[model samples]
Target: GTYRAFVDQLPRLDALGVTAIELLPVHQTDPQEGSYWGYMPLCFGAVHAQYAAGDDPAAELAALVAAAHELDIEVWLDVVVNHTTEVDAAGPTYHLRGLDDAMYRRRGDGSYIETTGCGNDVDADHPAAQDLVVWSLDRLADLGVDGFRFDLAAVLSRSPSMMSRLEAWARTRDVRTIAEAWDAAGGYQVGRTWPGTGWMQWNDRFRNDVRSFLRADDGSAALMEQRVQGSPDLFDAPGDSINYLSCHDGFTLYDVFAYDAKHNGANGHGNRDGADDNRSWNCGWEGDDGAPDTVLALRRRQLRNAWCLLAMSHGVPMVAAGDEHGRTQGGNNNAYNQDNATSWIDYARRDEFADLEHFVTGLLALRARHAVLTQPEWWGDALTFLDRRGVDGSTAGPSIGWSVGDLCVLANAWWHPTEFALPPGSWTMAVDTNQADLLDPPTPVDASAYVVGPRSAVILTR
Candidate 1:
């Protein structure tokens, strides 16, 4: 099937340490606009024929799964049950509208509900709608998928019973379920609710908070504190959020710090299609330039801050592809239509952005090395800290602390650099996010305090 070609890329992804593959909406979609992001769906039962492996689509899916299972990589299908691509009376009439238009969608005097603003929002409150969603999921479960990423998941919660039933059904199979838990009307909450029993969410709070911190905006530190801790304020559990600085919808991470205003002239929209309230600071220039060293240093630091937060945060961190190499859309935050070189990964510029890539690799490695960073648990007294002045090797508390066996993380987000006293014994520096020379020899500092660079992170192990 056509999907075999897509599955063939798994080995390369696996080589890069990608443990999971989040497939973008495999469901049938509009053949007209083509629904590039896969948010617009046409059918829940059928896989998009365009993405199928070959003539026999089901066989291709099975082969893809077998290959992925052999490599120990989990597949997460992107499912869009919120709305169908068949919108308006003039659009293509698909399964939902064809079966029972009145029951499948919410209507106000024969007009469809405009909640998703994609012409029509599915009336998930109806039993038929819920059945279709559950049936689609069951089909995927039988296909041996490891998980699902629900598109526009808040719409499901509009009918609590439907959400609850879906959750119960999902628990029967061993699979991860994630929800895009944000709504345009701000009706959705990130924590456990109707559909969030074992479901995680795309943490918009993490994105906004981290963006603010990278831009050095006012009150950013307070917002960042929540994001760093996995946004406990939003989620009931620690792992119920996906921390990301950039994704397919927003500006690329590099563009976030490089362009204050979006240049979307290439998209034929005259910059009207993208967001204007981007909390971005371009260091000095609005776009790319042969800038001076000082400007370059500032831009690098900003990138480092965002990357470090994503790596250190207590959630399933998702790095947008090419973010490691500082890929930019030439300041076009929304490049859904410009499927040219602007959106594709440029292998030639890998060396140009090598430093950023190395920084990200190092940060992720550091995170993987520390169980305290990833062990989905809420902060408590066990996660204690010791200040530089109080590092007497005592169990006494300082200001910050996290425990995972013999490893501990201590951060001083203060403006000035401070000394962190290590316990008496040999302690290795697993990672120093601030220092360029990550493999530099470990210096034997006073047991009373080791100097931590200003606004830096240090991973210490005894």
Candidate 2:
């Protein structure tokens, strides 16, 4: 979509109550490369020309940023300084590679290092390389971008001085920074190892554990409890985690319950490109095609359940585009090549999954209203984990419940209903995923225990 088209969606996004918008690598990609996802940056200073409806891509991008700021939404751009479009020895020689071979990491034999799995990794230790990255950051900040998400940022950790330079730049700009926190070469620096102070990280552990727990995987309940509390064991506090279930890389929220395997033949990799361990459950059905209405309804409920978990979690929740409205990639998790309808968002789905859209909107609004959900610190003494019977100190079952201060979330992943004992107080039910209008007017629960529907979540506030 063009920058103008993206700006048009800001009103709807603002109404959905998102505080920030994270755009995938907008840096211009080589036209000859034909990469759908612009991760392979041709030049960091240039905006992808195809993303602009007008001739001046930089102006269009600036306008988009200004419009988002009008609504008080920060624009976080994803950047790829880890590697470039000029991949390996056989690849095209773009700016850096053509100018100096040492710009890329090389072995003693002069073979390129493949830390990012992109054939070549940028040598962050090189003086010229560091200059290039810092200069790009300055230019991008001048474009009015508020923050950045560094793709495969663990590569930067290898050069501590370069990482320091980046941290200094971010401090000077007073902007937020996030890291993918790992590289293809098994460099996983998730928590404090991520080096950047005040920088957040994409917590894949939350994604995996939550998916496994919802799908009733064995021994997933305890992990779910930890992730729901913002992955305290991994990070120092809640704000350190950019908790997400699905992103641009893998399955969308809809696909998480609609497919069991990666259908990436469309990616032209013989169905072997994307991750096989998707941790997805198809709710007793494979593809959506010819699926019975019963399965479809169950999938919708599961989708809502996922959203409920994300909204109630104690950290920043990342919602992938079109996920609130049941967007699917036809099971093609890696649809980078298919830039056609498989990857394009169909707004018509918004009406089809209107209930889900409403649910997401209300759920996010609910999170926005509750400071407990966004608090940067751990729940500490204010948190309590309960079992299916609502007994404290036991959450190793298909059902789980947790409360922080006045807010409580009870998730039942079982096929049967679950009885949850509410904490002592007059409680109001703010969300019940079983209902068609998930955020319908709150109802007063005059009981000591509430029965959550099969595979649904109930949020209560006292």
Clashes of each: 14, 0
State the lDDT of candidate 2 residue by residue for 216-247, as single tens digits.
78788878878988888889889989999999
The residue pairs in collision within model 2 are none
For each candidate in turn, the TM-score is: 0.86, 0.97
- After superposing candidate 1 on the true structure, give the runs of residues whose Cα lies further than 4 Å from its correct spot: 1-12, 192-195, 385-427, 434-437, 440-457
lDDT of 1 by residue, 432-454 (tens): 65655344555433354576554
Q: Which numbered prediction scores highest in lDDT against the true structure?
A: 2
Candidate 1, residue 380: the lDDT equals 53
What does the lDDT come to for candidate 1? 0.70
lDDT of each: 0.70, 0.87
